[model samples]
Each structure stands twice: as structure tokens, then as C-alpha cells.
Target: MDDLGVTVSAGSYRSTDPEAVHFPHRWSDEGVAVQAAFTGAHLLHLSAAGCVLNDVYREAQRLGVAVAGVRVSATGDFDTDTWVSRGITYSVEVDSPAGADDVAGVLEAVDQVAEIPRAIRAGATVRRVPAAGQE
Candidate 1:
């Protein structure tokens, strides 16, 4: 995540970073840690990582699995000339006290329901509308 990717870590895996943007999280008292530059590309990846991290906690609770931490990393590249995204890929790591199988089940469930990742996977049409006062 140094140059080509973005990472979001929460719970026990979260490293203290005063500069990182923190958001309240239900599973983690310290919330989530965002370590990424403010750029279109980084923001794009951050969206995915953030979604996955949240889903991990959500699914864990739904499945009655105990999760201590979660870290999600997302990476992608764009066609330099056109600036079209090549693709985005992400991985999730969970620190848990539950059995491996239980955690795995939660991860699998999150993968199926993580909204941002699913949206990116299916793609979407973008449309622009002028401001109410101007054309």
C-alpha cells in the first residue's frame, strides 16, 4: 500500500496514526485507520477497502464469530493514457479468537454482500447533471 495500493486497518490490527482519517466503527472502539493519499485513485481504492473492513465486522457479528481485528487492502491501476481503471482487487485479513473455519465463513459471507465491491464488480453508468442554477 506504499505507492500502488491503499489499506484500512481496524481493531487490534490498527496502527496509531494521528494523521490518518478515523471513522467510528461498531466492532472497534478506536474506529478504523485510513492510510492513503487524497487522490482519485487512492480514494477509489479506499472505498473498497473501507467497505470490506466494515463488512468483516458486520458478518462476524451476524455469524456469532468473534473478531479482534480486520485489515483490508485494495489495489488497482489505470490506463495512463485514458485514465481508465484496469481493475481493482482486494484482500481481507481478520484477527479473531474464533476458529479458522468460523472466521472463514464470515469472510465468505462478507465477500458476497460487501456493497462497494459488488458495485464495482458489476460496474455502473455515470451521468453528470448541471447545478440547479446553471447549465
Candidate 2:
């Protein structure tokens, strides 16, 4: 089993600062669109996109294919009425010296094993643990 962890702290809604926390890895919108910044639905799509991009390159290397560049766009629809993610769609463009069939094969292999999408598709349970000092 593969395990990964990340922590996102709440940011001040009234702050002028870009990020709520000073952590190096924190993502901010320059204090604009704070609500969207913290929305889990948006972050979920981003995570899936990031996973696909990383896996593309990794799989390319493993397949001995030289990829000049890669771009992935992922979008998910959220049903506010039901508070659920309805579906997700993604498109990938890869610049490579390998033949089209080879590149396609690589992409398929990556899709099969990319972590985030797999977890989401498999319905992984999220267990929230309170902070150490929390009651």
C-alpha cells in the first residue's frame, strides 16, 4: 500500500496576506477568492490533475520514451444541492518523440496506476483526526 499525507490549515478570511499559514508548501490565491481556495472539490480536481501529470512523465521514462512536454486539464462538476461530486473530465496533451501508439499506451498505463484518481474511483474512506490539542 502507498500512503501520502498533506496538511492544509485554515486561513484568515480578512487577511491581506497571500496565505493563511507561513508554510512553504501552502497554496494561496494572493488573498483573492478565499472560499474557492479552501474548497475541497476544487482541490480534488487539482490533485487528480497533478497526479496525472506526474505519472505521465514517470511512465514515459519507464517506457524509454522521451517526452518533451505534457499538459493536463481536469474539471469536475459539483452538485451543490446534493453536496457531491457529479463527475470529472480530463484531457491530456503530450509532446513526445515516440510513436502515437506508444504514447497512447504509456498514457493508458499511467491512468491505470495514478494514485489520486485510483483512490477516488475506489471510494477511499477519509478519517479526520483532530489536532493534538483539540478537545
In terms of TM-score, the best-performing candidate is 1
lDDT by residue for model 2 (1-135), tens: 111212222222222345533322222222212212445766787677667766876788898887766656677776667867776666677777789999999899999999999999988898989889995
User: In order, what lDDT does every prediction score?
Assistant: 0.88, 0.63
Q: Which residue pairs in model 1 clash with each other? A: none
What are the clash counts of all predictions, listed in order? 0, 0
Please report how far candidate 2 places residue 98 from its true position, in Å: 1.1
Candidate 1 segments whose C-alpha is farther than 4 A from its true place = none
> Pairs clashing in candidate 2?
none
Error of 2 at 132 (Å): 1.4
What does candidate 1's lDDT look like per residue over 5-102, in tens digits? 88899999896878777888877999888888889999999998999999899888999998889999998998888988889899988899898899
